[model samples]
Target: MKDVIFDDFQNTVSESLIRHKSILDIITKLQESNARINRAIVKSVTNCGCIEVNAKKQNTLENTNMDIESLKTCLSTQVKGTLCDNCRDVIQNEIGNNLFYLTSLCNALDLNLYDILLKEYDKINTLGKYSFR
Candidate 1:
């Protein structure tokens, strides 16, 4: 006789979730779990790169400094074509940052990014014509 703990797919899925509590579980446990997760990931990466943060204030300061550095590196460029360097950099960085933030938000909410974008686009398309002054 073989022992069958989870005989069906649904049971198996439940068992798996119980075995490995995921982001959903974390979110349920902590309202600000996503922020905590981001901070952990950021700090881990920074530590791995030999950056140390002894206090929360210091950690935030370092994180902000890094963000500024990233923006500086990404935003600094020479114009060579129709799009000016600063303009292109600003647009690109803003889009990239928003996409990154949205992606993280979706992950935290357990939402599919592609599907969300498709739905959002459909909604905008349904709005018909609109002029901005």
Candidate 2:
């Protein structure tokens, strides 16, 4: 076994861009990545059924209230960092809920998650302080 490190994630992402790529391709790729991460989190918890059920629940609910703001609220209230393993599980559940909502929002909006992320980076690079608002 050997130790290896990749110091530049941004550079790797930038270099992966190809010509004539459609926005749907980017969104599909992101959706796939999120699915994989969601699976890994579920596996780590030793309770795949729990996360699977959460995903179903998220899909059924009409989301008039969901965002990063809601995630922060849940994390602060339900899963304070000072707690033990049982409490940390609650935090993981909250995060899973947020992830489901965010992914669903992307799907509903027909927005390419990766393209949106790239545009945000471009804004930061070009507009700097103006992007803050």
Candidate 3:
């Protein structure tokens, strides 16, 4: 059910990648797309004033008895407010562009985007809280 869309999207990306067929171009474009996403997010905060980041040091505690769920409460999304319609639309488009470049890079490397996603999902699911640490 899930992979139906991913396969379709990957196929579409493979067909759309005309000018940036080279691996070098794909990688660089992927990075550039990422940068654009960051800029779009920052712009939503600074220029559009739709969202603001209330970032600070995380409340990570050293209590050996603290459960992972409890530790999770100490973490914050570090963001305040919500994006307005225009900002939301802009951010979503930038993210979509980033995904396009990412899929393009995967196609250039002869990789399956869905397979990579499944592998990552399996790793995180198996490792649980220890996935990142």
Highest TM-score scorer: 3
Q: Would you list the clashing residue pairs of candidate 2?
A: none
Candidate 1, residues 1-133: lDDT per residue as tens digits? 1123212322333343442256654444344444555554344435442333333222333455555445445442232224345444544655544444444445556566656656767777876333111
* Per-prediction TM-score to the true structure, in the order listed: 0.33, 0.30, 0.91
Alpha carbon lDDT of each predicted model: 0.44, 0.48, 0.89
Candidate 1 TM-score, true structure as reference: 0.33
Which structure among the candidates has the greatest lDDT? 3
Count of backbone collisions within predicted model 2: 0
Per lDDT, what order, best first?
A: 3, 2, 1
- Model 3 lDDT at residue 106: 85
Where does model 2 exceed 4 Å of error?
A: 1-83, 121-133
Candidate 1 regions with alpha-carbon error over 4 angstroms: 1-83, 130-133
